[model samples]
Target: MTGLVIVGHGTRSAAGVEQFAALVERVRRRGDLGDVEGGFIELSRPPLTDAVGALVARGHRALVALPLVLTGAGHGKGDIPAAMAREQQRHPGLSYRYGRPLGPHPLLHDALEQRIDAALTGASTAGADAGTGLSGADAGTKLSGADRAGTWVALIGRGSTDPDANAEVAKVARLLWEGRGYAGVEPGFISLAQPSVPAVLERLRRLGARRIVVAPYFLFAGVLPDRIVAQSAEFAAAHPDLDVRVAEVIGDCDALADLVRERYAEALGGDIRMNCDTCAYRVLMPGFADKVGRPQRPHDHPDDPVDHHHHHGHDHHHDHDHGSVAVVGGGPGPDDLITVRGRALLDAADVVVVDRLAPQGLLAGLRPDVLVVDAAKVPRGPSMAQETINAALVSHAKAGRRVVRLKGGDPYVFGRGHEEVQACTAAGVPVTVVPGVSSALAAPALAGVPVTHRGVAHDVTVVSGHLPPGHPDSLVDWAALARARGTVVLLMAVDTIAKIASVLIEHGRAPQTPVLAVQDAGLPEQRSVSARLDEIGASAAREGIRPPAVFVVGPVVALPTTGPTV
Candidate 1:
């Protein structure tokens, strides 16, 4: 049977060492693997060589070495592998298969949720004890739905120099926030990255979160975890009104041990698939361009007996090829409305060129290092020239970075997405178009105004009203539209609704035709105004309805209350 060696980046703290050993014991207790041992590359206790030797002494020549890390950083990608290579030299005939880092896994997410729940429970108990005169078990209970909704989470990770590793933490935070009923979840680092523990906590407070839980995304008790707690305490003391609680690290639990076993099995089965798309050493990320194609070297451990000689001769020359660009439709307002494919692309993107009407909340979940170019074209205000935006997309894709041009609603619906696509194609860059839920249809539907009804309206026409009815550049057949009995949905027509209404009425459409204008449709601030075809322009203007408002005309506008069955 192949033995398992759990490789860890050793910590200075004795507690951390003990916890790591406990986790090893937990994994060993499973009994499927004949022999299991764990050791660190640097800092504390039984060095990697010791663990390898122990397994070797136990008659286990073939071994599976799994990195006990949340992300594939320098330690997992380079240091541990380099150290294992040295072991192969020492043992002469020993062989081992390296495993991928164990993180962004479902089991780890469950473990984090448990920790967060515990923190909230403990806080609830403390509050009960202070006021309700309750004690012990009676006081400790799960927080109510209201309490959970009011609280925000700050996921803290032992930050790394690798941008890819840091991004993994942000990804975890985003995953944790999904469907968990928290106010929000933001990622912060204990070291080596931006938005430190205190900084994230302050941000949470500023966002109107009274209760905050700082969940350390660590595997065991370590100096970093301790520091996270201390920093949280200091911040809590400073802002006495804020209820800040620190959740414990994911200590030696069965969930973690199970994950280790799974990793060990994967390593033995040669199922190791590392995500290199966003790796700093492979991808040319912004602010970390120097790391691209960089060679990996062994970390120097002060406690190790071997005389470590730094090797700089081994160089890896990777082809920094151009990455593909994705024109993703961000859907109407809410981030949750974005398509699964769109969200996935955004998650993998190195650069996101965002439009003004796109889901802005999605930006908070992106990696802190990602370059977000605000390509927002504010109505009648500052706007990014379409040429400049198109050039930016091609340039980023050519630079070996995944670029996402995030547009609001459907990219094809007057979003000028095709123009950008042509630019990318001209530059020899591959581009993909992911369709979104357009506000043109979504706005009217959300306002209880269906564009189509079996008996009420058989057809619906969508038109852009950016130009007045009589403008020289206008292509809309006002007379033809007026003759049609079907519903007409007008987008970007808020500014010139009066002229369009007059033209429609003059062209034989009834002046008293029911009209519904839905503004900021499918959003929390969504509001609707109702008037006749002739009165819609004046009514919308008087009600302060702005651009992005959808105007639905004809019998279908009143279908929600008194229209066809289907």
Candidate 2:
């Protein structure tokens, strides 16, 4: 049976050291692995070599090394691996498989939510009533249902010099905010990064949050966690009108132990999928180009037995390639609807060129330093020329910066995505496209109008309505579409719907054919206007339905409602 070694970046705090040991014990108690040991790479007791030796003494030669970290920072990506390599030199015939860092995992998110809930519960019990002269958790009570919704969260992370690692914290903040009902969740760092604990709390206050909870996104009690608590308390003391509470760090819990075991299993099974797209040692980030292809070295530990005098004369060279561009679909309106590949590209991007109808909420979660070019082409209003937009993408890619052109719905569904691709190809820039959920189908479906129904409608046709029925540049066959006994979905046709409707009716189409116009589909402001084919234009105009809308025409639109009205 293979043993497991839980590697941690050792801390000065005895409590943290104890907690790490406790977690190892918890994992050992599961009895799934042969032997389990926990050790630190630096600062604390039981160095990595000692842990390896202990497992070897227990007759376990093969081992799995798992990093007890929340993100892929310098420690996980460099220090721990280098230290493990040194162990091989010390012990002959010893082998180990390395695991990825512990998080951005669902289990960690669940743990964070539990901690936040506990803090809120504890705050209520402690009479954390604003302006009541009672501060902290001195007086015990529970918060009402209303108070829960009014509460905002400030998640604090141990900041890193690596921008990728720092961005992970912001991603965690966004993940915590999703679905979990709170006023909002903001990311802050204890050090190295922007938006310090105090600054985040102040921003929350400025945003009109009356009750705020500071949730430390740490695995155990450490100096950084303690600093987070102190900063939160200081912020609370300064603002008597606000109810503030600090959640405990994720300590030695079964959930965390299970997560460690999962990582161990993954390492043993060779299922590790470490995120290298944004790794500073691989990607060419703005100020971190020097880090790319840099060799890893173990950090000096105070408790290490070795004196550690080594010389570096190795000449390592790597060819840096120019960056590429991705034309990604942002789905309809909600950021969650974006494809996984598209989201990943966005996360790795140095610059994002966004369209008017793209999911704008995603921009909020991007790294603070990412450049966002607004290429919004508002119909009959202000617009950015396509030539200028194409130039921006090529220029950014040529400058060795990852660029993403974020468009709404599917990039190919009348999104002019191919035009951008051609332009990039002509400019000798590498370009790829990520498909998205098109609003043409999503809008009608979201509005409870199916584009096609069995027997009722056997076919569905999607058309662009940018021009009226008889325009010189229009290519849509209105008469042919009218004769078809199927669904006809119209995109970019809100303004020309009146003339288009007349032409359809003048042909073989019935005036009473059911029609549904859905605006801002898949979004909070989404709403629909329904009427007969003949009256759809007037109905939509009367309802003030605007662009970024989808119009569905067919007997399928008359089907019984199967979803929410919006």
lDDT against the true structure, per candidate, is: 0.82, 0.83
List where candidate 1 sits over 4 angstroms from the true fold: 123-140, 309-566
Lowest lDDT block of 10, candidate 1: 126-135
Which residue pairs show backbone clashes in model 2?
Answer: 124-141, 125-140, 125-141, 126-139, 126-140
Off by over 4 Å in 2: 123-134, 137-145, 309-566
* Tens digit per residue, CA lDDT, model 2, 298-358: 7556556776542111121101123678899999888899987788778777899999999
TM-scores of all candidate predictions against the true structure: 0.53, 0.53
Please provide, for model 1 over 161-279, each residue's C-alpha lDDT reduced to its tens digit, 9 standing for 90 to 100: 57889999999999999988888999999866668998999999889988788888998776788788888888888987887877778888888888888888888788988998988
Error of 2 at 328 (Å): 37
Q: Tell me the lDDT of model 2 at 498.
A: 94
Q: Of the candidates shown, which would achieve the greatest lDDT relative to the real structure? A: 2
Alpha carbon deviation, residue 322, candidate 2 (Å): 30
